[model samples]
Target: MWSAHHRRTAILGWLVFVVLATVVGGATGTVTASDDEMGTGDSARATKILDDAGIDEPASELVMVGAKSPDGWRDAAADLSRALDRTGRVTALKEPLPSKDGKEALLRFQIKGKSDDAADQVQPVLDAVDRAKDAGAEHGVTVHQFGDASSEKHLNDLLADDLKKAEFTAVPLALGILLVAFGAVVAALLPVGLALTACVAAFGLLSLASHQLHLFETTFSVMFLMGLAVGVDYCLFYLRRERDERAAGHDAETALRIAAATSGRAVLVSGLTVMVAMAGMFLSGLLLFKGFAIATILVVCVAMLGSVTVLPALLAWLGDRIDAGRIPFLNRRSRKGVHASGSVAGSLLKPVLAKPAFFAVAATALLLALAAPALGMKTEQLGLEKQFGSDAPLSVSFREITAEFPGGPEPALVVAKADDIRSAPARDALRELTRRAGKGAELTVHARQNVAEIAVPLPGSGTGAEAKKALAELRADVRDVRAGTGSAHGPALTAYVGGDLAESEDFTDQLGEGIVPVFLFIAAVTFLLMLVSFRSVVVAVTSIALNLLSVGAAYGVMTAVFQHGWGASLIGSEKVGAIENWMPLFVLVVLFGLSMDYHVFVVSRIREARDRGLGNADAIREGITRTAGAVTGAAVIMVAVFAVFGMLSMQDMQQMGVGLGVAVLLDATVVRMVLLPSLMSLLGERNWHTPRYLRWLPQVSHDEPAPAARPASPTWQHV
Candidate 1:
């Protein structure tokens, strides 16, 4: 596939595939989930009832006013009320309802359009509000506009700006790091070019995938960002290998062929591991996780394919020009001998190898310590109040509403669907339920033709303990009321709980239920793959252990920073007081797979040395000495990429960046460089042990040549 003569075919074919995917994706675009698409249980039922009733849930704009008199406030609010009515954007407008304290009042408008598409209707409403505010100021009244539509627009804009900043910042930073590592223009650009094409194609494929599934608007940005980093990483691994082989005096064809066999095979295995890990998130049974898992997996698969095929072909075409325009200080070592400065590897390995128990225990202890905070970790998805900055006027308005109104914007809705809500029996039951609920929370009950809704104002963010406690008591009271009504002979009333807090709790709890099983499944599959690939139970099992430690450590670190608020200000971290519900599971799956990239590469080299009849100790020494440069370079690049994402303002992305960056660094350096060698050294010959029953399995070979003529230096052996 990577034949030197086929360079043009490989390059041109890749270009064509990219173009077609992009065109197809553009034609199809993406299908995003609206509130109806995302909701479940009682919330979902409520949505259906409203839809069946042909009731459009109005996108409301709340105008709160503070002025000298109630009459004066009404007059000021009337300006916005009239402005909204005149703009013709609203289906209806309501008169100002003054608060118990004459200082504040509420005015509401039902904006035009489907609630999901209501952001478009916001601009005109905002324009009207702005004019109304100016008018209120003339009358010595202060007006602040807040609404569901206004909040959505602000969030949409914030996320867009965040992604744009990341794109502009991450690209140059990644390239600069690549330049520093490769120290040559062409060498650096090759990885970047290949990564970009892979991202374009991934986005194309993801667009098509979205229509079949529920994809959040944020999914593509995450895929593209991750694709860029991992794509470049795969290319970097293979390209570095090919360059090394070339420096060892192999021709371009031989170098690339060997890279295909070696780093190429590694990428496939690593990519499979990653995809399998990501696939586990599907079991969480959350549409959001499913979307991210699928999109990320697709992008990784595409990047790996490009690494193996297009990458080798490009190297063949570049030939000597791969090193064209090389930086001055970097080439001298390459011209003489490879930078196989196993010094960092050696310096760390020697003491650990000498005191295996001490180092092993010490390293494990450190990771476990980092992971300690994880035991106390709470998981809840952030609501708008937690997600948005306080600087936004909508956030300020929300605070005011919460201050003036008992429960803020979110109220627990008890929906009862009977054949006829107007029926005497149904009416009596609903009234009793509402009266019982009112004992614990402020309640308003309304009945339509067949459906009755009771709104209970339970304050604080829905995820908070206060809201949960209030909701629990309210539900218990409602159950008691319903049982007392004894509609046993009459039609049974269908009742459900629905609200923002209720939905958040449902999502969090459902995802939590699936996580344990998902973890076991992913772990089992990854272990089997490694065992099959390496033909050693010890290598596979140990790899899993190290990966778990790193992931655990990442969880601990993330929990500490975001949940415990340790050094939170450094990253501009939001104190969400819990890891995002999806984050821990997400980080576990992703980190487990990513941590394996270095583990497999380094351990495989050790196994290859052992195959050449080296002692267990000698093989360990030789393997670490041989691939130290490549492993560390790749690790540094990955860490840098993740750190860039951490620099963004979003809390969820911040948590992800911290987890990934810290874990990868720990996996590459401490786990691989220090603990692995120590543990293997202590275990000695047991490191390669596999059961006799496993001997019948088909043998898999990496880039090992058929008893090749020995190269000048052992550094160029399998490479």
Candidate 2:
């Protein structure tokens, strides 16, 4: 309550912190993860060898020229090459290579810089291609371009647009939900304001953090979404509790204290639990997850801090004015409280508590039925066509190019390194690799270096099953050729197959291996945290089980809708046969963490009711009735935000949005309202049973203190 007592200092201090962090973070700028650091297994080794040798691959781009006649296509392609050469942004331009059908030709070149800088430098090359399109207009010729640089540029642009859309949509949608929940404009705005500031502050902190641990391109968007969701939820919980206390006839000052003692403590515990679950991502050992863990944990911590300190301070300062601009009907209804006889929450809880075992069994069955589809869930690294949607220009170009040429756009690279790679044995090994690679492999040797690259054409679109099969065979060929063709003299050559396909395969395998450990880590830590917080073994176990159920159901829903193509057209999603490999673990941890917010908040309220001499049944009913409105509002807000993301064009965002939205909806409604109460009712007093061994653990009370028993000092209590 020191913050409440010094409201000006607290508010000003928070503002200054946000501004400084943003300024400092912006000044430092964010460092992005390099492909070398992102690669795994052999791909990583290959990249490392090249990186160590200071051999950076220039960006490879291709211009595909199509026409009714071969003459027209070749002429158009030549014009494109000359036009590209005139741009002075390209080098090593190659002659037009004819497709098998001879109706199209491909002009290949490298952007004249490090591949890392290609996305930025490829704009001129794209413009040159655009200009050459007109030169081929006569003869019905058409030019399409696709490559590493174009794909990167397109992804970046798409991400930027998604971020903007999220900003404009999520904020207003959250604010609208809060408006309905609070009924007062001022009261509703408070949570939105707090959440936005927390996001701003976390953004700066994440930028600073990125220097030590470089982040993925989408990290900021993820952070923003998480920050808004949790920040708003925490503040909503705190604010609603304060308002409830005030309406219960406590003076403003006393209401603030009680709210802090009860909801503030719950927020703290809930935040800690969320942070622990997010930490599970670190066990995945992927750079992508590491950045996500850092970003989410940072945002939750900032939101938690703001909830306990700045939120309470703001509530204190506002006093009666917090209810300004209240809608007449909603204000009266809000003041009428949640325990009314006609309340929907009460009616729902009545049946739940009446037949605890029956409701519990029914709810569990329902969730299990939803989860059944997950048993057959298949995972793969989605090709760009599926990821960005087939309608995307890049995907369209990819399809056309692959149809015309045996190898689509990207080629598999076989990198070999050793002392004297120019030796006769190395030459023989290279020749064997080319022979095995069949028809379309080209070799390039560095001037004085020991490394050589054989670019082998990949069949089908570079991201499809055909490409993966070809890559696997090529890698096996590398292994076999590596064993037999090495010189007897010094050291044998070390070869690795590396390219986009190789990276995807390695990444998929890495995630597949890491999933079990990550799941166990999250579940174990969550169980321990819930046990310590609730001081009950049953409570902790149930918490984990319920969260897992909800997560499982989410998986099933994603699989049914996305993988099985059941009603996918309704959501504008493509029916890719598999989910993204990174998605399962990422969704698992994120859902587990986010689901804890409702679990902790609702359970804390129930425990508080029970501690006040209510029987298990009555406490479940009472606790659920009192907290249901807020929890439901928070859930709606979360689902709305997630749904906005679901509407995005990117398959990853769409899946995340639907998966998270469905999980949150289920967690808040069926799981919390029906299953949690029914199970606790069945357990009765045993729900609070704690063994003698757990007596040594610290006791954290979330109950509101009685008027006379309340501490006098305006200080926040430590749990």
Q: Write one digit per residue (lDDT tens) for candidate 1, span 1-719.
A: 43344667888999999999999999998899866557665566666666666555677677788787665786666666777788778876777778887777888677788887788778888887778778777878877776778878877887898888877877777787777777788988888888889999999999899889968878877787678878888998888788888777886557776777777888988898888888988888778888889888999999988988788777767778888879877655433324645665676677777788998999999999999999999988776766664555666777776677556576787867777667777777787788777744433334554777787878664447888888788777766665655556365666667777777777777777888988898889888989988888887788889889999899999989888889878877656688887888888888887877787778877887888889988888878877787777778778887887787766777788888999999988888888898889989998877789998866777535643344453323312
- Clashing pairs for model 1 are none
RMSD to native, candidate 1: 4.0
Output the lDDT of residue 314, model 2: 88
Clashing pairs in 2: none
Model 2: worst 10 consecutive residues (lDDT sum): 710-719
Question: What does candidate 2 score on TM?
Answer: 0.96
Q: What's the lDDT for all of these models?
A: 0.78, 0.87
> Scored by Cα lDDT, where does model 2 land?
0.87
Scored by lDDT, the top model is 2
Model 1, position 329: C-alpha lDDT score? 70
lDDT of 1 at 67: 86
RMSD of each: 4.0, 2.7
